[model samples]
Target: MRSNIPWLRTIEQFEDEAIASTAVRLAPMGRIDTDTLLSLHLGMTDQSVSTIASRADAIAELAALGSFDHAKLSKGAWRMFKDRIEFLGCVLPVGWLVPERRRLAPGQMASAGENARVKNTWLLSGLICDVETGETLLDRCPACLNLLAWRNLPNIWSCQVCKLDLRSVTPRQSPPEAVAAVRELARYLLKRDIRLPAPLGDLPSPDVLKFSAWLSYFRWLPEDLGLAISPKNVPAGFLLLKRWPTCFDEIVLKRMKASTAEDLAKGDVISRIKAAGTLSSSVARLPSAAAQAIVKSRLETLFGFLDGSSEGFQDVMVPISELVNSRF
Candidate 1:
């Protein structure tokens, strides 16, 4: 047994090395689409078919679990071939996520660098609209009521100084009016029992957009949840909500005996990958009734927590912590 020890050590070390290399490759790419990440794990680059990405996730789960205990029985005979798993399993993906998209991300600019304001401004879109008329509202600036930035003061359409409805003096833009309409909708939702985010788009950071767009459909909740969500992260919130109860399920973090883990191994890792595939960002292109329901549920739960009057959120900004990890 002692003589065979080196063999097991080498195999375990190789697996760790493989996964680490892949993590390094993935870490720098910023936000990577989960589908691409899984495809790389499965050892294909051409994207020859549209197989669900979770198959690869299953394989990766198998790989992650397999790493914990290297095969003592197979080590001596398959030492060399074992390296293939690490290379193919992990290294391949590292290469795949590294700047290989139709549109490359621009490098970050420091202060006084490239025009940061323009890039950020263009990065966002105004999606405000009136619920009753379904008309796109204008940018009703809260400061001067001249259609500028989004604000959270009472009486959304009122001019900050004069306390007069700006629309009475001058026509409000579609975006601002749309936001106001959404807030009113939020108020109505709280009056009832439904939960949702409101004001269309009032959040500061772009990350908030994902939740706003997701919860926008269920505006019967509270406006405090989604208004002013930043534009950049709207997509991620969508992605997370799409993968609920399993992607971040508390059970995913539970501890089990080694034997139980092994018992689950038959379907454990593979099932995870498949589950992940169901929500992989790539799923956005495909339509499924079941998928839509799951996504909708997640959006409901997330905004439900945010919209609850007890949360005491006064402004339109969503806290990064609650947006990401609120178990409720």
Candidate 2:
């Protein structure tokens, strides 16, 4: 064992150098997508297909474990790769990795800083509608309903006028009638995607849209559970509800069944509304109570126009009373 020490040390030293060089190349890239890896070029040399495949497999294997511990995860991956793979050296130069895509995120890439505003506006849409003004209100002292300016109210957590903590201020909630109207508008927009404005063509991906919608709508439940939600987040709360068949309670379900001939028609609004609410800022920004009242009035008129009978109109209106008690 003593005689073999020198030989073992030499092998270890070489391996350490190889690992360090390999790490340097990959560190900046963070994680490479499959297609990008296939055609990867470093300086004047192109990476071998076999080398990329092995690296991809190793990364996939580590990801499969779903662990948050970086040290433990890396160690495990290293052990598995020790026998089969060797990190000879990086095939690419550092210069090749420096690109605009790495520096500017998807949201940052959006023209005129619209990405952050879009998300913020979506999160604040319900509150905007709740206000009688029908305009986007970013910073208002919730306790006194005094408009707060960025120059005066530098500290967001505290209210300038009321001197009360902003988090403690309860938001003015829109009526259920307003919420249903917003949902109906969301449904209409999704069904007519061809009519969507040119500016909103770059909406978030499907999964992100679903998550944002969920967050916007369901934020109220946490507030109900004694969470200190700021009044500014009130619009986010309204945005959380999605139009699933199960989202509505028994009464609304019965009403929908009587009105629509098919179960597919009943579930249609639920499936479509998620996409609608996520993509269109205009739909989200519609005046809450005002929009609902408009929708209700239009719907009543249309129903009357289609069926002149008072009995037929009464059947739909009767179910809408149950709309006030809707859960979705």
Candidate 3:
């Protein structure tokens, strides 16, 4: 990689020292959302649609059922590998590097210059079990990184691990009021543009508070996905995010819906979820519909501010462009 991009180089020094340290300490593990993991095995890792998008298509097409070492790379991708490395600041690693038990993001890896510290596919597989109703889907396990399965486990009742006795059970945990609150909060967050009025610490029941968190979770996806999964006024052709096969199980939903001792307000949901109160602790630990809400809120703010500033600058520049053109 070129070492002459002044802004890029300067920003590296400006990055938080602790963040870099934490990044280095965990870069080996790479970025795996632990909250999204369920069960896993060892094989050729990196199989998500996201990965496919990130990789050039020829590479993806040539990928056979068991081809690993010598990847079929088109000339374009090979050259891109060079250009990518220049931009990416690292070599394209050729083998399975055992993953260290650390969690770091791709951005962090770029900043820290630490490639796979170890080799472990943070993946899941098999029927995506509904966390609440035990409904199995042709989905992957949220805990482990693996491709989802549907046909093999038609009536499998027991968990692959810990023999937790996951099977057909009466699904009676959803509360009507709780669902309403969850749906409203989700809709609000899905389109949250301006700062929301501070939650007036006046919500009812702990269940209601959880519904708030679920709202936050639904907003984390891209806008289209957000619309599809939004609770209130979901678009005409969109399905609720709860039906999403990529990133949910009834278990997580149940936890989001489960009520606590007191119904906290909106702000409380953020503080409590971040602080992780007892009931909050269980549901807030990982990516829930709620945690996603928080992330969405933050990103929306960040992007909103950025987009606004960009628009304003462009508006200001319009007259200058016109004046310059007049001289010409």
Candidate 4:
């Protein structure tokens, strides 16, 4: 065991995996993935562990390996990584978007200051950008389109598969509004005192922001809406903006109504309710009665839009009504 171990202090904006991964590299552990390193050193079986206690234990164990048993880790090390949120595992070097005056040698990787540090919020929200520089974070290799998360490379600034220096690539221009949207989200994630803008602020809890991001980025909502600025064009985090709730609601309601109507038209009462049931399940975490009522009203109005028939409306609304009742 190396007594003079170069343990990198955790940057406040670095995600747990990023911190762990960089620590492994500085430990000269030779390219081991974060989970394997944790399992080998700490006997941790759960790769999804993100609790402060768990992270503190990991720091203590890692320090022990370096013969520093009494080393103290800061509480700030574990503050930003939330266990409830799933890992996006994406990273962007701090200066990736800014063009360098001098090009890198064929194999040289980019570094921000001394080392690359990814933003903590980007790991959660999958919004790739450093807001201050107005630069988008590159999560994919420009040469091969290989995802950054696909391989646990020793250097985060180089693509493992293609050996491409990410700093050498030209970046796409992110929209100003899109960057602003992501900036707001990152601010909210970092500081609890900072309230999210309107409509998003109307949400019951900040946890819902993750749900909304999922719906906007990964779910079928974008396709259904035929959004002018597709999720691909801008950061998916932009869809969580204060201006987007009405558009999101309209599309979701439209989708639910269309899906329900199609099933009802086939005279499948069970299928129609099943479709509505899925929607209800997705929004069950919404705690506001007013929000629930709005969803219910929109769902109920689906009947009015469908051939002006009231029959079977109650049947379709059963799941939604139950959701509302349960929440209230």
Whose TM-score is greatest here? 4
**Candidate numbers, best TM-score first, in rank order:** 4, 2, 3, 1
Cα error of candidate 2 at position 75, Å = 37
**What TM-score should be assigned to candidate 1?**
0.19
- Please write out the lDDT profile of model 4 over residues 1-328, one tens digit for every residue: 2233433433222332233434434334424555555566566655532332236666666555544323233222433232332222212222211111111211212435444544433343234455555566665667898665523445555676787767677655567977776666555444445564553566644334543443453245436555322223234533544444455555555665654433334545555545555565445433345545545555544433344443455444445443454652
Cα TM-score per model: 0.19, 0.20, 0.20, 0.51
**Of 3 and 4, which scores higher on TM-score?**
4
**Positional deviation of residue 7's Cα in model 4 after best superposition, in angstroms:** 7.7
lDDT of 2: 0.29
lDDT of all the models against the reference? 0.29, 0.29, 0.26, 0.45
Question: Against the true structure, candidate 3 has what lDDT?
Answer: 0.26
lDDT digits (tens) for residues 181-260 of candidate 3: 33343233233332323231222212222333344444343233433221222221112233332123333334445233
Off by over 4 Å in 2: 1-119, 122-139, 186-328
Q: What 10-residue stretch in candidate 1 is worst by lDDT?
A: 96-105
Tens digit of lDDT per residue, candidate 1, span 1-328?
0111111211222321223222223322324333343344444344321121123433343234234332321121101122121111221111111111111011211221322111111111322232333333333334455432212223223333445443443333335544554444333222333322332122222222233344332221232444433322233333333344443232222321123223323333334334333333322421233434444344334223223531221111222323666576
Q: In candidate 3, which residue ranges exceed 4 Å CA deviation?
A: 1-158, 163-165, 190-195, 198-328
